[model samples]
Target chain A: MLEQYRICQTTGLRVFQSTENLIKANAVVAVIFLAIGGLFGLSIALTRWKAVHLLPADWFYLALTAHGLDVLVVWIVFFEIAVLYFASSVILGCRIATPRWAWAAFALMLIGALVTNVAVLMGNSSVMFTSYVPLKADPSFYVGIILFAVGTLIACFVFFGTLVIAKQEKTYEGSVPLVTFGATVAAIIAVFTLASGAIILIPTLLWSMGYISHIDTLMYRTVWWGFGHSSQQINVAAHISIWYLISAVVLGAKPLSEKVSRFAFLLYVLFLQLASAHHLLVDPGISSTWKVFNTSYAIYLAVLGSMIHGLTVPGQIEAAQRKKGYNNGMFEWLRKAPWGNPAFSGMFISLILFGFLGGISGVVMGVEQINLIIHNTIYVPGHFHATVVAGTTLAFMAVTYLLVPLIFRRALILPGWAKAQPYLFGLGVAGISVFMMGAGTLGVPRRHWDISQADAILPYDFPGAANLMMGLNGMSAILAALGGFMFIVVVVGSILFGKKIDASTEVPIAPPEDARVVGEYGNEDHPAIPGTIALVGVFFVSFILYYFVNWKYLAEVWPLR
Target chain B: MSVSPPQQKIWWNEPVPKSELIWVIIAFIWGLIMFFAMVWWHIYGEQNLSNESYRITAEDFSAKTEAMVEKYKVREESGYPVVHPPPGEDIYLIARLWQWWPILELEKGQSYRLHLSSLDWMHGFSLQPVNINVQVHPDYEMVLTITPDSAGEFGIICNEYCGIGHHLMLGRMYVVDERGN
Candidate 1:
């Protein structure tokens, strides 16, 4: 049993060999897919840019399909599986449950991703990620997705099993670590998400192969969103978990109120899935009542959950910094933070952009009536690129800087490039999100091969500014692609050839102290988080102003019922 | 503290911080306001999506649209019918693979029960300039009562991708004044 585990020199955690191997395998495959997806994303962006219409129509659609699947589903989910295993087994100090079965799951996911990519490249499955039925893709496309979903489902069970093993072995004291708890929440959401995938994709698969006669378009959309949007919900949970984990590791920060944080996660498990309604708000065959209720997630309790997290995460960091005597001014804690560390910089940028751009725009367009103005527009993609790419993807990239050293046991190569990577990627994605939203507000369509309407029988000219937005978006995509390339090169090169950590290796951050009873704060009632409070105050004010501005925009649109 | 197990044996009994508690309360109230605002908009706001939809066959919707085009046809432009339907009438619009068939002309400030559906695949009824977008599905008829408040030539672009030719899918809506200019 002792031989199965090696004590990590930096953190002093017992790392099981089997679990480490699985995480390494998953992370490596995820990076490979990220490279592929990032390339496709750059191509599509260039195609959309009227100044440089890169790909022809057919190839553009095919690239779109491949891009969405690879990045949104394959890359994120693979990394998440790695996250799930690490959170449950490593954090809890237990062996992974069924290591061989976990390997089988990995194999299935890898094969599935490859098959789907091949099918999409075969040119028949040019249907966008939604794959709305009656516009059928090749049968293998559906099969590949099903295989991937099943593998993910198995991985979720492995997570749960590891949790059970941790409990049975009495690995920890009272409660699981907050990061593991968050991962538990992610795993629970993943189970529901994958089940929804099976419920819709199986029938869609049968229909594609002529086994079933027809699938109602509305029904397909309704159920498919249960899979599609809920999958993003999973990303939210996982990434938020990483947020807490990164803050804790990098700054030794603890949540102000464990009860509040845990309750927030509980809210996500209960109400986040209802976000599927955001996609269907402007669609037919659903009632306004259903849309309002579901989109709001029962009076926006889920949003409240996010709001709480938004405050508490940075609040924790501020409190920690102040404890270290950086409380000279309101922004001193933030200014004194480890800006040179890619982990801290990446995570911080992600937090800011996700809240301001992604969170605000999401609520605005998610309003039932307001959806009519921006649904299916480039604004939709703009909103998600902020959340998924700038927010979640950047956070993931940030954590990689830490993980490569800890798990891969190799010094991160190109430290200079690594430090700058988050800014480049985050700013580029932010530009993409903001500009796309601007163009979409001017009524630019998303997923179109050309915005210029060059081949239209009766072309309608968009405003001159909309063309400029696409051009800017194209440039931003290139910047983001460059950042993505840096990440891939740094991560791959570090793992393959960078200096290995040994007894002589210099560990920058001090090893964390052993867990001990946390004493009450100096006040015992009010925590000194003035900086976080001030920041959150700014967030609330911006949220209110932006939200009402959208409502004002809604008021100007043509009256409808 | 998040990466390692909790230091407290019973963290459930940990004292809640005033800062976090206050923030949660504020957030909860804001959430309530956002929820009620949607409901308020439904009651008082002029703009809202209609819940009126029916299960429609593609062929049936297509035939109805053809009939409306034939009845309301004023002229032909670029091989498509230019339809000028009467105000407040139940007008049909067909969304197909590469076009929003039968370009529509209506008077500004007049309401129309615009019935929209697809013939072959799902498409988006994205009326530009005005920027009123809605999802159109095959086998489903969406009835939207819209009042075009401004006079202009509005473009209908398919935002939902149908195929390789999706970008070329264009339709037009001309909202003129009482002068019909």
Candidate 2:
């Protein structure tokens, strides 16, 4: 099996045949789920639109539950597993340890995902993602999630095993690549996240089966968010790693200061999971001290970590572009960047949108007082759509374009559509996020199948603006669905029907110009990243502006006595 | 045919540039500032949820809420309890599957202790237009004081996903003048 492994000509990284197969399998499954989840998403969006109100109440909740699980847990985690294999075995040139075990994990995950989906579709498990106890679902729903988490837990262990094997095999000298280190952080956090899920979910599963008498709702929320919000922390770490990887692969970008970058990753490991407490900020039975501690003091350290990455990713790209002599004025390097390449353009857009939309709103929503207004509103979803969909999903989609030629050994089928996919998806998602948040600020309730509440005993009305915003959210969802459709077509077509190529013989799918593939990570320390410095200033201004705007909004509400 | 990752020393722990350190420090300061600002708001500013919640059995709480509603029962409108207890009195609100009970009628500018609890699943007290929201869970009575600054009919929408009729879980709060219009 080791003999079957070959060096990727495009990336010059080792690719174990078995590991490649696993990665391909996981990536395909992820895409399938993305399609399924995207369909459910479109239905929910239309249903909430008030004008269209697509699905009836029962189907709406069912779709919403499926949408949450498939997209948030299944799709992203599957892709992250692929990413883990790629980062570990492939990047470090080590054969994946226990390939048989990896397959078992994959099988477990697939079966678990299907079981959960079937349960939801069967109409017994419309309990939604945060299946708060007492409002019980089918036992199989909890069991499915448990099985999936256990499978992922094993996959994470496999990833760690690959790292240890690489170390013992002496595949590379010194520390692992920054991207690998970041993945390691994600893997470590995933252990904690999965464990939390198991801790609460096992009992909940028992409760669903009448084995347990009761589960405390508050305790359930506390621990559930430990699983729920921290899952996104996994995304944060994984997607940010991809950010580093993309900049390097696409532009030969080196971090401005590798030590500073590593420190940020360290900060993530130390503090990121604590931000999960933001979910319980407005919950009863928790102390103000705990809420304040989690939301403010400790959480800020995590925010700092993200802020550092927000600066350094673009900083690295600017440094690389300047080295290539695009260093005229401030943003000439940005302007001259390969806008046509989906990989670079997509990653860059993910970074920017994630920062401005997701990052800003997240901090505001986490603030204890500020959260009172937006907690459980559509604003909550709005913030996450920016982070998860626009940020992580977009990054994953972008990387898939790169993975096609490198791993699948096939050219992208529709290069033009691939090029347009990022902008369309990003723009539409941005619209969805902005419009939803706008509606939420206007006091539009979330998770409502009918925003009009037409069948209610007593008729009440939302401001006309809320209706308009929901209508726009529907329109944006259509645009996003189109983008999602194009992506599926491109990915599926490329994999199954596009022109196959020997990547070694031919230049693999528009390799980065003057590919300055550095011999070592952090070896190419440049003198200046001045353009990045300017950009960070702009980001700071935006962050301050958004933060104050929320405060102003909060203040405008009737003063608390 | 060769497949080997290259030996590369000093991958991490490289010397940080002065500029990067400066930005990190600046971020830390900004964060510190925000943290302190929140503390100030919680303490002195007009943004504090009443720190007056107590754990209770869902049954016990609901029974107490029923007694309170019966005591303050001003009228029965549309098969729902409408209560207007005295000013500054403890006001009881029950969140069930699809409604917040006892349409509250409060006097404007008179502080009232608004006690909220859920009888079944979790619900959210999202007082719209005013835009104050809090999660109302079973087994805990969440108490928040409110003196309505502007008198009007404020709709209370359950923001938390309860069930199929979570959307229809709407309650109204009428804050009229002292004359009880």
Candidate 3:
């Protein structure tokens, strides 16, 4: 029998209980947002393939707006909040600072999401959520942005409160637990992210209402991207934390190096927050110098961190399988790995897909000149979908199978199906990504209601290719939708109809008994803080300080009027 | 299709296990091949533009003469609009959403390449008769090589939003034959 960790209760409250509930609540919301996003994407595919604007151009724009907010903003961010809470409270062996405040924060974000979604559906603001300047929308959209920001900021505060209390309580030993450590870093960035939102979005909102006559698009774009790009990093950082979680759950493993993993995560805090200039690479106003520094060099730091994780992941699998007594050649452990484990398969495939379609494209597209051709192409969304949707979102889904029984206190309703959802979604996503690459390469632009309409001005033979790609997109999207729906059924059914699992019978993953190994991070005695991240942090902050002081001109003309 | 499993083998029931080195080597080779394929495609594809033209518009084309024509009111053998712009000539064409502005007005047997660009924001410029979708970016130009394979009133609509009047940004391209050709 495995030695299960006891879920101790204090004052009639389970420490892990609240975080699990929070995660489940957020996941349900993620699923709903996912469904809405998937539907809109399907419509887009239909519009392109069938060459019919099933919805009007206005509604399609509305759908596009809702899709961005719901999937990119609501879906991912909300899930991050849940993941953060879990990382802080349960994974760190600490409790939420005030569970009430956390719950209240969730409610606030939920309400904000509702308000924004309703406003979008009403066509009050189809400004693409980006709400780029000069192209104005109604006051409600801006208000929705403020409300959402406030909600997210408050949630960050709750996380901060939790972290401080956990620190005082000394929940874990010297270094923070890996998951909590990562979540804390993301929460830290959230402060800057939220502040940037206020800096730009609030003033822009005021400008929209004519409170202030005008705000330059250039100035607004910079600060807004401070919020925008940094928020994406938060998503990515949070995603990496989930990678650890999934590895442990699916493979019964731990990260290869505790210090190295933490270092990678911490690098995100220092470097990635300033890498927002990547998006503005092709924008006319920003200087090539700023673009080069921000897009290429700064981005490489995050990529390096990811690379560390990538290598470390395989290292972990090797170590874990070695523990399983696979004593053959170096690669024999890999051969013995639990390939049938759906979560494991999902993680590997997601890693591969994200690395190629997401990471490589992120670097390539960030190039200033290259972005001129592909900035507004469908490729942008394609890249994000690989990282956010394929990588992080799927990783979280994989974790649910392990977490549901522990958190919900029930076994998965259909464990078999739970196992299959990951690969199905992965395959479906890969197919969609491959198809979209075709559209993007040909410069088939994004945000379209109908391709046939555009085909009118294009040469006669071009629509055939575009339409063919769209058809592939449509097919893959439908497959993804089906996969998504299957996940919903499995997840929701697990929560509702699952068999009761006794808390006393939890499965435990402990280091094997054969060999007593020394911790590499601990100086043969205790855990050591890796120097890489701290050193990088110093350089990143110094670079930012230098740039802000010297290149004040970039702040003004970045976004263009 | 999935690999069929036999026995209780750890990774498929093969006695002679596949080497990881093999996988890595194959991956490397595949990467190289894909890189070369892409480079070849990009270089060769752009250079071989049989439909290349500086400007083909609605004012300078006629079917009666084999030489370069100066009026769009001409039909080609395929029976469609042919608006050929002579070298060094700049022209502006007005169009609404959801309609095609044919360079050759109801002229059939036409095959011509047209340069499309939107005046403001983003617009989808397509020449029916020939299935082409060239994005009429506000500032950048897109080339469309269209040979109207058939005759019909091919409709056009704005794929991207210009403004509230976006839906009515429709145009029509009529493919018809000329009397002489």
Best by lDDT: 1
| Model 1 lDDT, residue A460, Cα | 91
In model 1, what is the error at residue A356, expressed in angstroms? Answer: 0.8
Off by more than 4 A, model 1: A1-3, A506-508, A511-527
Tell me each candidate's TM-score. Answer: 0.98, 0.97, 0.71
- Candidate 3 on A1-561: residue-level lDDT in tens? 211233632111134556666777876787677778778767766655664446767777788788788878887888788777777766656666666777777787788788878877888688775776655777777777778778788778878887787679876555555667778788888888989988887777788789887565456667888988888888777766666666655454555455456667777777787667766654433555566566654535665676566555555555555656664654666667666665676676676677666766665565443454445556666777787778877776666655666566666766677777877888778777777766765555566655444433333333467667778877887788778888878878877897866645544422333122222221332212222233324433443343233223222211111
Q: In candidate 2, which residue ranges exceed 4 Å CA deviation?
A: A1-3, A297-299, A503-505, A508-527, B1-8, B11-13
Q: Which ten residues in a row have the lowest lDDT in candidate 2 chain A?
A: A516-525
Q: Write the per-residue lDDT of candidate 2 for residues A1-561, one digit (tens) a residue.
A: 344787877877888899999999999999999999999999999988877988989999999999999999999999999999999998888899899899999999999999999999999899999898878899899889988998999999999999999999998877788889889999999999999999999999989888899899989999988899889999999999898888777777766666777789998888888877888888777877788888763838988998899888887787778878887988898999988999998999999999999998999889888988898889989999999999999999998988888888888898999999999999999999999999889788787777677776655788999999999989999999999999999999999997886754647443565354222334443536778888889989999988888888888776663
lDDT of 2 at A300: 89
User: Would you list the clashing residue pairs of candidate 1?
Assistant: none
Q: Which digits, one per residue and each the tens of the lDDT, describe model 1 over residues A1-561?
A: 443987787777778999999999999999999999999999999999988999999999999999999999999999999999999988888999998889999999999999899999999999888899988999999999998998998999999999999999998778898899999999999999888889999999999999999898888898999999999989888999999988887887777777889999999999999999999988988999999999999999889989999998998888777766687978898999999999999999999999999999999899998998999999999999999999889999998898898889999899999999999998899999999999999999989888788779878999999999999999999999999999999999999998999746848454344122123443543347788899899999999999999899989999998
Q: State how far residue A248 of model 3 sits from its true place (Å).
A: 2.9
Better of 2 and 3 by DockQ: 2
Q: Show pairs that collide, candidate 2.
A: none
Task: Kindly list the interface RMSD, in angstroms, of each predicted candidate in the order they appear.
Answer: 1.3, 3.5, 13.9
Cand. 2 TM to true fold: 0.97
